[model samples]
Target: MEGTRYLDSEFRFNSGRLSLDLAATVRRRASTPIDVLGNPNACGRWLKAAGLFSDVPELSAENEEALIRLREAIWKLVTGAMETRYPEDATAVVNAAARFPLGTPQLQSRSGTVSVVSDDPFATAMSTIARDAIELVSGSLRLRLKTCDQPDCRMLFVDTSPSGQRRWCSMQRCGSRAKGHAFRQRHELSVRA
Candidate 1:
């Protein structure tokens, strides 16, 4: 439901990339300029200030760098999607912060309204970790991900199954129709035989 806004038939084959999409959705949702590369600093800072990263120095530094790259990749994908550009993937984004988990050790806020007085390093770390998690989900579900075999209906979807043999984004929609037509052809052949 949250991602219903962006997940269309055009991106149906990306059901495995839903986790990545979710983060994109959130980033876009919180975004102001609306441009793909509007203001990475402002957006990145906002996420960090919002308690999304960790306060540790070494970990936060690594995450910050990864987050910047991830944002750049995401922006490229968004621009590509809008311009009908395909082939670009989300692997870079997923693997960037994949080394570290986002939310570890439950953090608490004892002060007034949980504000990081000095430079909020933790928030930055958390943001990248969040992006990494989405990437992991994308990788895990990549096998099930499918681009509709139909030339016309090239939608994407997660082919959740034991056999990993799903052929269409929706059988009731495209699969059933293809089957019906095939059955009719077979019946006609039988009669001719």
Candidate 2:
């Protein structure tokens, strides 16, 4: 609600994986964290911007609470998976979230071609995210999950690069800041010498 800054374009869809993106809804996980999902409206907007829903759904306060719970569960599960350990209650939470109804794939004809489209935006968004979390933790992609190396920014991401050596949430954001900080420190040290 108050921290609308997180809903800005800069914070949307940078993570290569949707589940990682969801985990990143909270900024600065290590310190001075900001909860981006400050309200149900914010959560609905995030879902829409994430492309999980074509339009923002009307979420109740209970839905907001459930989403926040799921978000924390996802974060714990992912971080634990990275360390080859499962966080206590993480599996149960994820399994419970997965039990939510999922979107039904409906075949529709558009321009004389039939294509499957997802119905029920709310269910689809939640179910897809839950499934993604399960897959990431239980599949080979678990090895690719990483937390940002930026000191104050501990966002999560999937290393999609060919080298799998990515360290920042975004090159233009955290990477540039880190590079500039290193350059300034070097300059200061040379001056002192």
lDDT leader:
2
Minimum summed lDDT over a 10-residue window in model 1 is located at 6-15
Clashing pairs in 2: 1-38
lDDT against the true structure, per candidate, is 0.46, 0.80
Q: How large an RMSD does model 2 have?
A: 3.5
RMSD for each model, in Å, please? Answer: 11.3, 3.5
Candidate 1, 35-90: lDDT as tens digits = 32233343344342333532313334554455556655554443343344532454
Cα-based TM-score, every candidate: 0.36, 0.87
